[model samples]
Target: MPKIPECDRCRFYCGSHYLVCAVLPSGPDGKECHHFAPEPNAEPQELWEPQGARYIDDELVIERVTYNGEEIIQPPQRWSREKKLWLLDNHPMFTGLCPSCGAEFERDFTARVHWDCPECGWKDDSV
Candidate 1:
């Protein structure tokens, strides 16, 4: 009697040299054994992860959004490398100076939401 792969993990396995399992003593007919029963003290299986996702440092890192009691997975948003560098170079909030008059804003310009320049009368409406 040849033992199948699932015979070792099945609870009904006889574990004897003469008999294979109590359910099917002569061994199962096919690979898909319907009478195969799992052991109660078996080790837990690995977690199932969806496509395009991965585990990092034993932690699952994925972007998920809940809508209408359903969870939707989506990729995280990020600015392009070139666009971020451009913002650091051109944007007044980072530059701390008016683009038109080139007048320097106060050191605490980041605290102020509005970037209106008093020198050139430049109104900041790009909110």
Candidate 2:
């Protein structure tokens, strides 16, 4: 059988002809081209995500709100990059103290974002 490897992936592919490759008009020397390069603009793959979904730390976050037994999907509120970094550094769970007041306090489970300092009345404006 004739050696005709898939030319569509070759970087030298002219994109007009299905079998015609740029390296050799006829075909590869043997089963495949010795210097076959991948096409820079090959068929792009489509990426699909659920509405109101976002990626955080390479993980997708989707918010689904249900009311009256009906499922309602809403996108999670976007947090600024600075706010995220501040949380990672100064949040009581990580540092065990208010970034502004330096007073150690337990973090509220429901309110994990910006917090108020009980000792110095310092308001966290990062998040």
Candidate 3:
């Protein structure tokens, strides 16, 4: 069995485990310390942890799962096929006005089969 170290009898010892003390936080390099003093109560110190950190019913709950070392999240929904088709017809990006000629529509003529201008050969990809 290993022998108890010198800091065990020191007054400033704050043994909460993982090598911690009030005066010698990381513990003394040698078995003996200059600031060694007897504890006021001189009772055996027991190791402990936070109330939430300890096991509840003999089962640990601190375990966690990750996605490639990162938390997994739900991705954003994609646009529907119908919405894409509607945007292609009415949206200005697909069809707006003739580029080669100065021919513009009064209202949105999205149902038109050919987007090419009648007066000019300007085309809008026939969208």
Candidate 4:
């Protein structure tokens, strides 16, 4: 009952649990079988896998990070959260009024970048 490795690639191999092959029912007698005929196509082939990946729960999972076909650039934050909150609450850019003279700025603040006050001559140096 010596099951030789040549049984998998042999032409007379009957893919079964009980039977080893058609030519030899209990497999080959020795390491090399005389009745062994090479089968071009073999069953139970190994699946091809990509590098830097592994099979997890029968699914292929990549280890490295993958991004879309676009250049990624992140600008540094100039001010802290407290400074931003202070600017939003008191600054003429967000309040639409000068902090020194209390003069009302232009209603359309979105279009304007420079928040300089014309009445009190308060220049916007924060931006």
Question: Which ten-residue region of model 1 has the weakest summed lDDT?
Answer: 43-52
Which regions of candidate 2 deviate over 4 angstroms?
1-77, 107-114, 124-127
Can you tell me which runs of candidate 3 are displaced by over 4 Å? 1-4, 46-127
In terms of lDDT, which candidate is stronger, 2 or 3?
Answer: 2
The CA lDDT at 58 in model 3 is 40
Q: What local distance difference test score does each model get? A: 0.74, 0.65, 0.57, 0.74
Per-model TM-score on C-alpha atoms:
0.32, 0.31, 0.30, 0.38
Q: Estimate the overall C-alpha local distance difference test score of candidate 1.
A: 0.74
Candidate 4 is scored at a TM of: 0.38
Model 4: runs farther than 4 Å from truth?
1-75
- Model 2 clash tally? 1
Task: Mark the 10 consecutive residues where model 4 has the least summed lDDT.
Answer: 69-78
* Candidate 2: RMSD to truth: 11.5
Candidate 2 lDDT over 1-127, as tens digits, reads 2334456666776544344556676667677677677777786322356567754433566867888999987756567679888788877657878777689877564667766778988776554
Task: Write model 4 residue lDDT over 1-127, tens digit each, in one string.
Answer: 5767767778888756467789889887778899988898876433355665654544665555435865443334577789889888889877888988999998986677777889999988656
- Find the 10 residues in a row with the least total lDDT in model 3: 49-58
Q: Each model's RMSD to truth, in Å?
A: 14.8, 11.5, 18.8, 17.6
